[model samples]
Target: MGWSTKQIPSLRGRRALVTGANSGLGLQTALELARAGAHVTLACRDAGRADGAVATIRDQVPDADLEVRALDLASLASVRALAEALDGEGAPLDLLINNAGVMATPERRTADGFEQQLGTNHLGHFALTGLLLERLKAAPAPRVVTVSSGLHRIGRIDLDDLNWERRGYKRWGAYGQSKLANLLFARELQRRADAGDLALRSAAAHPGYSATHLQTAGPGQGGGVGDRLNALVGRVGNVLLATSDAYGAQPTLYAATHPEVSGGAYVGPTRLGQNRGPIGEVPSTRAGHDREVARRLWERSEQLTGVAFGLPAAEPVAG
Candidate 1:
């Protein structure tokens, strides 16, 4: 009756790249896109898992156009390599889904010495987007959909302690910061596109407590008690409040394919505190729409990730 994944328009000729597509929301998003006739690339850290996801999608759609590619979001080098590889292919990317992320976990640093959550959740995707900007622009109506979280409400971008070097890191706080950065990045990207007259559109979405392995795989993907607790709570909470991975993926799918979606718009569940429901437009936080903060975050992200997005000239608007 209402707009659902099945209602999404056909994407017959579109090519989509979805990060963390091996499981959970990412996998569901990728499969749905493929089912809608888009050729999907499953970008994941584990080649085996990516292969499995491709297999699963093929099993369902039978003729689904899918590919598995390795992408470790925690590593800048990996992001760069992936971008370069995609660019070398010279294929137009119609959709870019910044879906892979890490959740609350113990204090730790990535190979680049960034807080693990921030590194994988924000920086990795930041760099990847920058690298793929040209390919996105090559498309007729490209869209970049970044997945954020409700925890962003409590997040404050600590420029002085971005890496959690000066202050002690709290797992939830770090996760919140990363998720908040996601929203800011999407907004800033849209602003930049408008200013520079880029054809690509940027949008953000969040899964309302979808049951995923993020909690379990996140905390201990590096191995620790924090991982155990994260996984345990995620599993338990999933039973009580979390929705199915399919339902959880609705927001992202909507953001990616909805023709009415605008740049800088945020999408998520439309009911019950935004934790679970049908995918629809939702109000974004004031902070999420702060142009100044978005600009500053963009500059900081460029500096931190060393990936510059070269935007085109802006179209002048009549006053």
Candidate 2:
């Protein structure tokens, strides 16, 4: 009976772009937005699969407004390509769901040489958001929603060795860092917008234990017995505990559409361990609110991604 998709405001004439919209939570997010009358672009890594996703959506909402664009968050060039293409189209984008991501995965680097998790989950979205800032600003009211995770509670950001070059790599730790960065980046963006007097709303959300391919995608990559066990565990968890992808997506939907949702808000399930339930404002870790750390991470992200947000620097507050 809490805030569900039924409360979503009419999105007529609003244009939204959802990353990784080919399946799982991303697809669910895209579908609901389309149902609410938004012209949705499904930016995905695989073109064929994206087509299937579009078809699946159409099957449910026959007149759904949707398009598929190829996007590989593991590559900076690919992120820029999609942003530039949208720029060429010269249409304002009202909603941007930075939802595409990889969970715990084997040690690997993106095309830009950053750790794959941080690159895809944080840096890639960082670049895309910056590159498309103008497009967003063109709209009367613009919002960006970045998806994080409950695992972020344990994340520690190591600015000096963010790519994990100096220390030994831990897959879960890397994912935690990326998800934590999502929350940090979201707040920083809002701070910058307020400081610059820009009309932009930035928010973050986490799908509390959603049954998606993300749980198994990473573990399924290895051929070892441990990997197989991990994959089996993920599948079991999906069936036994996790909520449906559509249900998990409610937080993101609420964060994206709820009129009362303010800038810098972090939305998540409001139940046991924040894993599943009605959506509401949830507190992030203490680290997620460290202004100085968020500022530093923002600068580091720009340096690593080579994408400037082009917003004014926040003035120092007088004591």
Q: Which regions of candidate 1 are displaced past 4 Å?
A: 220-230, 312-319
lDDT of each: 0.88, 0.93
lDDT of 1 by residue, 1-319 (tens): 4569988899999999999999999999999999999999999999988888888888999999998888999899899999999999999999999999878867878888889999999999999999999999999999999999988988888877888998877888898889989999998888888888888789999988888887566565546665666677777887887888999899999999998998888999988999765678888778777666667777888899999887642333355
Residue ranges of candidate 2 with Cα displaced over 4 Å: 316-319
* TM-score versus the correct structure, for each prediction: 0.94, 0.98
Name the TM-score of candidate 1. Answer: 0.94
Candidate 2, which ten residues in sequence have the lowest lDDT sum?
310-319
Please give the RMSD to the true structure for each candidate, in Å.
2.5, 1.0
